[model samples]
Target: MAPDPLRSATTTDDTAAIGRLGAVLAARGRPGPVALGPHGPHLVTSVADTRRVLTDAEVFRFPVDVTRRATTGEHAMVARLRPEQVARGTRTFEAELSRATTGWDGGGADDAMEVLRLPVARSTTDAVLGPLETMCRDHVADLVLDWVDSLAPIIAATRPPRRWSRARREERRARTALERSLEDLRVEQPTVSAVELAAGVQVPIAAGAWLLVLLAQHPQAAAAARRHDLAVEVAWETLRLRPPTWVTARMTARSVSLERGTLPAHAVVLVSPLLLGHLPDLLPSGSAGPEVFDPQRWVGGDVRPGSWLPFGAGPHACPGRSLGLAQLTALARWAADRHVVLTEPARIDQTRGIFPSPALLRCGAVPSSPEE
Candidate 1:
């Protein structure tokens, strides 16, 4: 049998093949949590299986050839904020999030949500990015969105370092923005953390926007999210349905089987967080599981351990997840208690990095419900 060309670019949706990936996991010699396929065999899917692979670096590895090449000379940028750096930045980020939505009287919350979303980029910039963190919300957000925007075209096109020039330009712009922020590092940098420094803060800041987008989708869910009730669970469900990264790409470390069959070593792997969340073993009753949006499941131990990897697993998990969640919880908690309506429905594009950015969410103030 010949491999299908549909799954070539993990960044692009080439076919409906993803819908049938679960059956592949259960078939053939593939067992033990990992499943390799004739088409997308490179990816490792099981929660338990991935736990093993992620924990054991020697057996599995993320080929950084592309990442390294693309990130050339950016090591210092990454190393600047050490573990504490990431922690402190998260703290600073958290404080700001708390400061933003504090003392709300539950009146005109829908309007407040809209106002906040409109200026989110700049507000986020103030927290993470330095001075270049433009106060102009929409345009600032546009700049960030534009950079990720190039991702699809880059992957879809053919040419060696073909997208190199474009990528470099984006990097240069980002670097320049960082350089501006660096000028006042002593004063501006004290609160800065590794995540802020490494990700330029905007990367992680984007999570808030995403949660807002999802909240807009389900009035009830958004209300639940706003109250920060079992926020972690809500966050997990959001990850399941609208994962930041629609697909995860990893370079094979050694020739291995998907608990199923033979697969070549060093193969490019695509693990869909979207697909992983739907596994029956992990989900009590599939995607429609009772705890699907219930945060209580996690609190009551109904939640499966090592089964969810919204921030991902292993060395590459998103470090700023805590900060993102904190902000999300506060926002969710606030919104749920008030009368809110997402006036401007968000337009989302998942083709960006595994973490897709919601391009827009126009908000309008609405009267609070009588419950408030």
Candidate 2:
């Protein structure tokens, strides 16, 4: 009914609004209908409160479409065993990631960063959507961008009718491509496939790409990530900073006092992981030094229980975290990291400009081998 913070972040005038979100989330209530309406603008803090609200599923609901409320009927049906299925799907996801990384490597040939982008997407697509009809080693960058926009238009006001129409057609093609591939998988490896898992793949893949973009920018952090026992820290760090879903929305089920202000039913709340990740006090840059890259910061503290939310805090938390972690690990282990000379990192744009991506990350690769 009102302005959508998620949508607003992509516009020209969103600078102030996005800044409001950062500030409000840094100090106010957990994001949702209540704090959003109560505070001067909308930026949600209170990770604990946000977790509480999300955990109380009966109160906060998410729908796949506009006409519905709550995870019921089709939504509930799909989510019923999502957790179990995701666990089962992980093995396959990992296997594909491994293949993507090493399938082309030879015993005596030079190994590059394995030519990232497309290969990641190719195996990712296969893992999520079933083996693609073709084994395209190259990822479709423009295709993926168009697909994301089609799902959530960056420019909401108006797209050229022809452009929108073309996107719609391409979107259908992508799904249909997956569907056809799924059919083939069923015929060959039916034991390993599940429709729900297929459906869940896109979100994580897109989120995975976002992680790549984020990690590539911060090489020092990426170096820290490389030293880890597992890449979960890397995934968590990226998520803590740049969550794929900027703001999670909820309608006030009843009157609520959010400390910042009073909120009535139907008000929307906003939550901010971006603000929470940088809480200098929570991260105390003490004798451990300036708190630059402490994975241990999340190890023993009260962080994951409620306060720190990279993959959200509660029940409706993102379920695709494991798959994301696997993908990150696969990339990390196989990485022939070229020094990250970021030409321009992603920016919070308010004008007619594109969101940040690795346009020209000019760095020499430390190829996995010496032979040419």
Candidate 3:
């Protein structure tokens, strides 16, 4: 059978490529751990198996030096921060969204991803670094985005490149720029490091873009977002379908048992939240389309949301998840008020985390009830 075009861009070397490989593994129907690619890195296909690997952080510890060694995991910082911090961050995000969308006249063409860049960046920067002069905040946001872009090639490479490679050099330069920009803040907030701030900033930018892309593609979902208090559901639905960080890896500390086989110690283990999201049993039964975008499915409350672990699960799950959802929700409201339509097909770019490149969207004000 032909590959499912909905889940892919039909590109030979993109996230679709990885999705195709995942499909093969999923077809095996709970087959024991199997190699994800040529040399090694066995994949854990089932949710139960994936959860076991993530939860047992001791055995599958995060590879902190991922540039030099294999690695993948979510944040530890989210758990460390106080609730008030998160609340303050959400407020910052709302303010930033309004500031970012100011010039969007509701009748012009703009790349949805591009539109989100400033607001998401500014919001996250404010949340992480606290109040800053407008110029400094904008400059810092731009640097954070540049650093994120620079890390792409390093991440997408099958194996870590040599220390002096061009990709590594670019990543280092970008990282230095971002760190230098944050140096003053580092001194002020001794406990909050620059690395944590960058992670907190970057992921939401991508995830927020993905949410807009999903809404633009699915009109019903988009309409629901505009007409109701469903940003949380919309955010969850978007994450379910196209989580930016679709793939994460862990190295086994010891031999681990699978349904069909045993993965020896020090083996590379792969898990995909995208694949888990597609499992029939995990989603609502009467939703008519499990694979299609349907935010309403979340309204019934029959099934638990986020079983797919969009932000991740266990101890290593994303710390900024709640805030990330709030940021997306804020954007969703902005998007909801506008009649946003895709100007071009949004292609999946997986050089870094999965995101919609060229997510061009045109926006017009949604008719008010009186206008309607």
How many residue pairs collide in each prediction? Answer: 21, 14, 1
Q: Candidate 1, overall lDDT?
A: 0.45
Q: State the lDDT of candidate 2 residue by residue for 1-372, as single tens digits.
A: 113222332344645335444444435323332333434233445555656555655555453232111434123222233444434445444555556545333322221222343444444444444433454312332244334444443223253234346655655565455445456545343222233333234445444544454444545555555555436655665455445455555655666665355665555555555555555544433413222334334544543522456566555565555555556555445443433333443344322112233222343454343321
Best by TM-score: 3
Q: Which stretches of candidate 3 lie over 4 Å from their true place?
A: 1-5, 8-29, 63-80, 131-136, 187-192, 367-372
Candidate 1, residues 122-213, lDDT tens digits: the string is: 33444444334334423444444443333334443344344358665665465445444344444334223322433343333445555555
RMSD of each: 8.4, 8.6, 4.1
Please estimate how well model 3 matches the true structure, expressed as its whole-model Cα lDDT.
0.70
lDDT of 3 at 141: 80
For each candidate, the alpha-carbon lDDT, in order, equals 0.45, 0.44, 0.70
Model 1 Cα shift for residue 334 (angstroms): 3.3
- Cα-based lDDT at residue 280, candidate 2: 53
- Model 1 stretches astray by more than 4 angstroms: 1-41, 64-167, 176-206, 222-228, 284-299, 304-306, 343-348, 354-372
Q: Where does candidate 1 have its weakest 10-residue lDDT segment?
A: 1-10
TM-score (all chains, Cα) for each model:
0.61, 0.60, 0.85
